[model samples]
Target chain A: MGVRGIEIKKKTTMENQLHIPTVAELMAKGESPEILFWVGCAGSFDERAQRITRDICKILAHVGLRYAILGTEENCTGDPAKRAGNEFLFQMQAMMNIEILNGYEIKKIVTACPHCFNTLKNEYPSLGGNYEVIHHTQLIQSLIDEGKLRPDDGHIFKGKKITYHDPCYLGRANDVYDAPREILESLDVQLTELKRCRSNGLCCGAGGAQMFKEPEKGNKDVNIERIEDVIESNAEIVAAACPFCMTMLRDGVKVKEKEQEIQVLDIAEITARANGL
Target chain B: MVSQFIFLGILTIALVLFGRNAKKIYNNIKLGKPTNRTDRKSERLKQMLLVAFGQKKMFKRPFPAILHALVYVGFCIINIEMLEIVIDGLFGTHRAFAFLGSFYSFLIYSFEWLALGVLLSCAVFLIRRNLGHIYRFQGRELTKWPKTDANLILIAEILLMSAFLTMNAADYKLQQIGAEHYIQAGAFPVSQYLTALLTDTQASLIFVERFCWWFHIIGVLAFLNYLPLSKHLHIMLAFPNTYFSNLEPKGKFKNIDSVTAEVKAMLDPSLPPPSGEVARFGVKDVQDLTWKNLLDAYTCTECGRCTAACPANITGKLLSPRKIMMDTRDRLEEVGNNRDKAGNIQDDGKSLIDNYITREEIWACTSCNACVEQCPVNIDPLQIIMGLRQYAVMEESQAPASINAMFSNMENNGAPWKYAQADRANWANPE
Candidate 1:
């Protein structure tokens, strides 16, 4: 029985059994988490953003903080609709999700996509559903600052040259530049800067709902412009906080056929790895 | 007395042509849908002053900006000379503002310098368009009518400025000779050199001066009428267009009012559900766009700055923001022409989409806002692209397969993925 128990313990992978508790499950048990993890459309589905979402979850769990995801209850924040000019469709989606959140009495919301973050933090108030919205990078920065989440020896990213690519919505629209930079600094990696960083950051050709369709005809690709900026920075890893920027920059890397040399990782993914998650 | 009548005759014809063309443009702009740009009054005024008057956005590309400012400021201030021209044309007076004395001399000197500036700038622009063959001006869109329109305007300005200078030069010689009816009025420092060329007899010199004077004044009148048909319409429309520019945050797309109302009612819980079906989804014709959008079409300088900045255009995509604006103006002009002939626009069996602007062009747009940012006149090409895209996706269900997949995913899974809602949390629990 002792040998069997040892084998069972070894098979219990933390990655497979993240031990995620749904908001409903917690509520049924008469316990409420402090913050609701609004895993956005990309974070919930896209393979790349999903990794970032998991890293966020791992960090939250490791910090021993009480947090819960909406599970099946969360919906897309209707960013693409508003951008694609489908205001009707956007409202329909926003209303359904807002109704669910208001019903749950959820207040503080944290999301990974700037698209979702912008819509929730800036757009949701006008629709009469208000919540204290925080981006994942902002949350990560605060956790690091408060000594709640400490970085390890930075085995993977230590001394690695990393540069950040700002998402148009986040950097230009919301002005949340420092939080991502601060979060990246925690990994003890050498941080590089793109010439057109911060307010002047180029779009990854993914904002304004462009991610759903192919890029328009033009002399140069916008993602190529952004990736060129990253390449010029001479950073080994491209640090992206927004999933849309990750998608665009990753595609741009493949276009340049430099995927073997340069890696694109989200801030959360790098931070989570550095913390030995 | 007969000379005054001739001047009045030319003025009457010019003003009539100008008035008729202006009325037609006003009516065509009225054909577009209404949009409220009345908010933020102070900001609107500031935009006008900075963008239209200050030429703030033009300086992004310094060389062209300086040349453009020269021609622009020259054209405007030189028109002050027109006040004198009008008084002279009416009352048979020479240098009517000559009573202002040194100020008049100062003004004419300034006018002569500006004429030289306008002359030099127009020549360079013409060479750039024709011989130098600038890349932005060499696209397929500039092959015929647009190319000619650009060249014609430049050439016209060159001729007009030349006529003004020749007339001033001849008058200067006539003044030096003290010829009959040749008063010692207005200064002409630059044209003074040309007085040396006037070695012909005083009678012939007077005839040369009179001929140039007729050509210059008549040419100005013709240019006024020509403006309604040319991209030069921007001279008049840029001010109003910039004044009513969209003042919202650049990234924010306006919400559809009907949808907003419906959503508001749904969220209220106490309100009843919507009664009627949505009338339409998005723009399908020129009439659907705001009057400001139509105004934008009329005001486009055809400079291709937006297309040059467009990523889609850079990557060899069919989406050109300049082309979009041109197509809008072309279609608007077509409608206006039809109305002028038939008293109302008939169903012409054509629409802005597919006929003029293609689905490929509209769909190709990345919505990057680069085009909007680059427009010197504050024309938002992205708005038209989005409006057409809205029609494609919502009304016609003709979006690309990738986009259709996304729409379906959003409809069914509440996300832009094919995964079921129950499995949305699987990313966290990776098993």
Candidate 2:
């Protein structure tokens, strides 16, 4: 394994003691975790996706579920490459990550980004990598259903005008529509619905590797159109499941000068806050 | 006999012209890179039947859908009559199918009704395009040649159908007067009504019938060849284009082969280091695209439904899915012309990116698949946009600054940020 060799170079920098253990660290102690938290590129680095990663981690921790992160060994699942039409770069990224993943004998994976969730669950199987991949919302929803975690009534989110924006990958691409909505329902918020929600949900303009590029010159920005749908719903808080949607919708809110009026938050962030984390 | 010989001469010229144009189009489409769309034969057949033959997607909008279906069915059924005219023109037989008697009358009656339907449908379509002020038609894409092309086809159809009715009406009048050589054959239920307006000179009626007959036939031949240049090519190519459409889950993207090989090598230490210069990823030029993409370009009806459905377009982004397909077709045509003259594609010092479709238009695509979903003929403009963006980012390194930051972050930190890999666990620890 390239683990020990690569670990030595960055080992000294791990001075801050975090509760999360790397997969290599766990396996070194001969412990096999039940699930691997596949914190995607966005979750690992993006400030917003990081918040989602932490909230999801808190939810798992609150339920006392066994999970570990790959840390240095993990890499992007190449969802961007496939979307950008650079299959070569995507394959290079996917094959290396798949090798590392399969080496650890990983079985179940949970991710925050719908892009990663889509790629890891659907696209990776054909390349000889397979795992039971679940989005964080689905995992958390199931946990709540199993009575592993409970939401208290009269919480901060109770009776709030919250509308959920479905991420394209999670909704249209994978048909995981109900899980996020079900999770939001637990918070006691008036679950308002956008006219274009669920299967007809409009994209937040971050899909198809569009997050990485300036939107093509067009009559209007897609995020603005998506945000307009949210505005029409007249919900005070715009709830989202995917980190990319969070970024795009947040930007759209700012563009419409509604950042103060409408709050953009991920399901995990809102859930973690609701649970008094 | 002399007239029959003259008809044969004219027919031969028309066939040669049509054949030459068809061959050029076939060659142009062949210039694209090959893709294997033959994997799912049954699915492709099913798709062709539903989308192309059944017009299932078109029915989403009731009014235009019905009119389009009428014109489509009329175009197909009217061609059956064209076959008869060809046989009669060749053998100099008057009403060559008259031998079928009542069955022939039924066919003629149906053709008359269809002819009327076709005429009315074409007129309505023309009105919708030129007068309706529909947003899809207002875009820059509909200007000049595209606009003229659509109107010209409708006008041509209207003229052709009118001539068919006039020829039949005059022939019916001539037959009623018991004129020389006016065969007492064929039903004229629709055109018989027109005979009420005819002047009683038998010679003038013969001239009108002959002129209308010649005009309709010549017009049909001219329209046949014009299809390769016009968006009306959808009339013929829709079947094969729909048949070859990508049947995979709409969001799935194909893995690049060389990238796969290189990655496989990286994973297996026993495999020797990969050799040979790697090919550029994604599409930048006409030849880089799959042939099915070229077929899509040629098959586009420019109906602009895709543009109308596009979120980016609706929000006032420069991206129009219809424009993407049109630009691809236009660039393909330019490439075809270049290839024809140069014997092979050489750098014309231009490509689809800057020379035809702009980088702004390519980048504007949100990849929402709304355009793909809205396409009546199953043309996936998002695929072309993705291909171009791939070329822009990987090959040219022309990705916007923000994307560059994301890419760099991923390359250095195993994620799309400047944070160190070890700090990833810090999200768990919090501040």
Which candidate tops lDDT?
A: 1
Residue B139 miss distance in model 1 (angstroms): 2.5
Best by DockQ: 1
Query: Candidate 2 residues B1-431, lDDT tens each?
Result: 98789889988987898788778878878877778999989999999999999998898678999999889899999898899888988898777888888888888888888999999999988888889988888887887899899899999999999999999999889988898877777788799888878778998999999898889988998888788778999998999999999887666666666666777777688998779987767788988888888889999999998998777777787778999999999988888888889998778888888888887787677677778877889998988888888888778888777777767666676665577877765565544
lDDT for each candidate structure: 0.84, 0.82
**Model 2: CA > 4 A from native:** A1-35, A45-73, A81-89, A132-166, A171-201, A213-220, A233-239, A257-277, B99-102, B174-193, B263-270
Q: How well does each candidate superpose onto the true structure, as a TM-score?
A: 0.85, 0.84
TM-score of 1: 0.85
- The 10-residue segment of model 1 chain B with minimum total lDDT is B248-257
lDDT of 1 at B298: 95
Per-residue lDDT of candidate 1, residues A150-187 (tens digit):
77763567888999988777775677889999888777
Model 2 agreement with the true structure over A65-172: per-residue lDDT tens digits: 889999867888878756765565677677778889999999999988888988888888878789999999999899878987777565577888999998878876
